[model samples]
Target: MTDPLALRHEHAFDIRINFDKRWSTGPVYGGASIGYTSIGEGSTVEGPMLTGTLVDYSGADWPVVRADGVVELNAHYMIRAEDGALIYIRNLGYVHRPLRTKGQGPDEEPDVPAYFRCTPYFKAPEDGPHAWLNRTVIVGVGQRQPKVTAEDPPDHSLFRYYAIR
Candidate 1:
């Protein structure tokens, strides 16, 4: 069996931000952003595109109001293939929170925190050549929300090609 990791294309999509919250905020502090992009299939390719941001907010102190420490998420989705033709899929997003440590002794080192704790934002139909350009929202501590804009259309020139030996 071929390895899925190997079969996958490298950076088939180009994610650029018009303005990133991280740029203004200090490096260590957490923030959110919105992004836009077009999804395309290279040379008759067909499959759903899974896109989203991976966030790390463990370093921040917990919120006093909410029981949760901090919320990290990827508002993303999938596109379904239709009638062997390319279609423009609407962009959809969702929010997720990372799992936190429970009652543990201070002496013990907190277990290595998981990067993405929430469930995946899955777009159904899982196959297609669709274009979905929507504003993705990522929220972090202190109710910080950032917006990301897509500067350039994605280039799929170097997509992976496979053939029977």
Candidate 2:
């Protein structure tokens, strides 16, 4: 038993999911994919990374809801960089609801503010300048947006990622 790993981090980038679409396959029990967990269609992301902008999105989000009202989300997507480099990202995280009491239901959490956090894994070109993304440990903080007016969508959110050093 030796010393524990020292933790240090820096802000990496942020992904703004401006437009979102979703449909659930229904939650299945006793499996990795489970109920009422909505699947996100290819939502668009607009952000800069390593001086490049993420231009395209192609993938889906697989989510599972636990009895305790926690949402496990696995988002797998491919993004095209402005420089023509394609990068793959998989963000696995959870949306935490208010702790439920005995006999309470998941809907009871609707009034409580939710907490969302996730760790993102990346796959980038080995020899590319941004190749460092392949080995860095990253964590993301999520901020959800509720519809403000008639023109605003409810599915929008921004996930800011940070690289742990």
Question: Largest lDDT belongs to which candidate?
Answer: 2
Clashing pairs in 2: 27-34, 27-35, 27-36, 28-34
Residues 42-75 of candidate 2: C-alpha lDDT, one tens digit per residue:
3444444554444333666667766567788787
Off by over 4 Å in 2: 1-4, 30-57, 101-113
What TM-score does structure 1 among the candidates reach?
Answer: 0.25
lDDT of 2 at 71: 81
Compare the candidates by TM-score and give the number of the best one. Answer: 2
Q: Which residue ranges in model 1 land beyond 4 Å of their true spot?
A: 1-9, 14-66, 70-100, 114-165
Taking the candidates one at a time, how many backbone clashes does each contain? 7, 4
> lDDT tens string, model 1, 1-165?
887556332222222112111211222324433232222232232223433221211111111112243333323322223343322222222223434367766676665453322221222333443222222221111112233356543332122211211
> Candidate 2 at residue 41, lDDT?
40
Residue 154 shift from truth in candidate 2, angstroms: 6.4
Q: Would you list the C-alpha lDDT of every candidate in the order shown?
A: 0.27, 0.69
Looking at model 1, the pairs that clash are: 32-146, 33-146, 34-147, 34-148, 75-94, 78-123, 81-127
